[model samples]
Target: MTDPGMKCTRCRQPARFRLPAHNAHFCDPCLDLFFKRQVQKAIKDYAMLRPGQEVLVAVSGGKDSLALWLTLEELGYRTAGVHLCLEMGEFSEASLQSCRQMAARLGRPLHEASLGQLTDGLSMQEIVWATRRQFCSVCGTFKRHFLNRLCLELGFDTVATGHHLDDEAGRLLGNLIHNHLDYLQAMWPVLESGGDAATGFARKVKPLCRLEGAEIRAFAQVHELPVAQGKCAGSKGATLLYYQKAMDQLEADMPGTKHNFYLEFLRQKAAPPPPPQLGGRCQICGAPTMSELCGVCRMLAQARQWREKRRARLAAEEAAAPTP
Candidate 1:
């Protein structure tokens, strides 16, 4: 017994459906084949996963992360869920709870760390306020650094993130706008030699980079995976949104616009500049860096400087304003 017609996830056309493993309803013939091929292609094209290797999945309780963890498990890779609680009030609690429930439902093990534990008594808000950097950079840096370090400490050979095709395209285009060839080349599916003091041999992989965020949303809907539909509580500003909207407009004008961008870039014989030559690991922490202090610390100091200048400017403006 099957529905004769179902909405296609990709093209959004009414079409027949077939059940994908893990209880997902995918459109028959075209979309089904497309999805399967996408998954296989990503795996083969990037060498995302290796046989019998353990993967630490950075789960955010979102469609993409959940889909990735489930897919890896279904594909027989040993997956350990890694979640970070940013301690952003209620939002953080809800995210952590949702992740825990999903892990329980799937009978998968999950590892978690809190921002409070990692930073020196610094909340994400404080970090942003002090560093004068935008919200995304502060949070992103802490999360990525913590995740990699945790993976190394835990002895996992590879770290998997839930960056989808749309995200990848966005980064590529952003880099292209600024001509950041080194960063662009780092967009490969697999990132080997993800250096960290704890796990000197940690590599990072992105298996879902070929799948669109929309596809992951569709998969979540088909499987009824629990997820948050709202934006992150800690999210603010407009740089990322502006870029995403611009790219979205391109996709609207031309179907598969994002995919084509990546495909075309891959066809180019472009490799990033050789890895940076490091003098020595930071005496405080053993992570890759050039100066005595790493980028994270430098960024944090810059954020603080920005905040001080902003405060002074505001105070000067207030003092100069005529009395009402």
Candidate 2:
């Protein structure tokens, strides 16, 4: 027996309010449909997909990725879901299972890559603890690296990611805060070929970029796509999580904050500037960068320096403390 109100997906309680678009009997289903449509439209308007091209989808077995996979298949794009099993603990097993179940249900080919194979003895936990960086970055880098490599190796022409509007907006805001204008420019509908590992040789696009997170959540609920609930173990204290939380809080207080900010971002018009010149490859990675060293290598170098400084501080503190 169901209550009169729409039901929540995470919790089986009746939804607080009616979502009109999906004609949701429950809030979750309504949100799911809304997100799917938004993703479908974004793909079409941005020309993100080609009819015959095989899309190498990076599935985390979560709502966002699952929604993307199903929607792309529904829209007639031939897709194969590829999952990277980071093996972060019990969560890794669950994530892998979710990925397999979803792929089997959707009847699409699913490929899996393991971090253990790629890391050359560096586990995800080792990288996070050693680098003093969140596992999200390492996991993201490895995932993107593996995804693109898999695509190129398998002859896939493009890669599709489930980065929605909220993710994009939060990223843009994060860039603004950090003054990383180059990355801001790189976040376009069709990214120009460059240093990005994901697009080194194959094109990559985000069909779900225009949709909101809530909408994606709703779409998944309506379609009843099998998605696992829980945060990535490596994501517990990630910087992106903090930024996302801040953005979510702001959006909650000021509804549509992310949506409106991005709409205005799209509508932005600026005075014409000089024509752009071409770029050369970085000496280290052969990837295009404004400087001789690519941004990624440059950042890693800075991180190493920061790590050294932090170690020295910790050592000094330990020396200064009286023996117990």
> Best by TM-score, which number?
1
Off by over 4 Å in 2: 1-33, 194-199, 269-324
Distance from true location, Cα of 2 in model 2, Å: 13
In the range 279-311, model 2's lDDT, one tens digit per residue, is 766676555446887544554555556667778
Model 1: residue 212 alpha-carbon error in angstroms: 1.0
Candidates' TM-scores? 0.81, 0.74
Model 2's TM-score against the true structure: 0.74
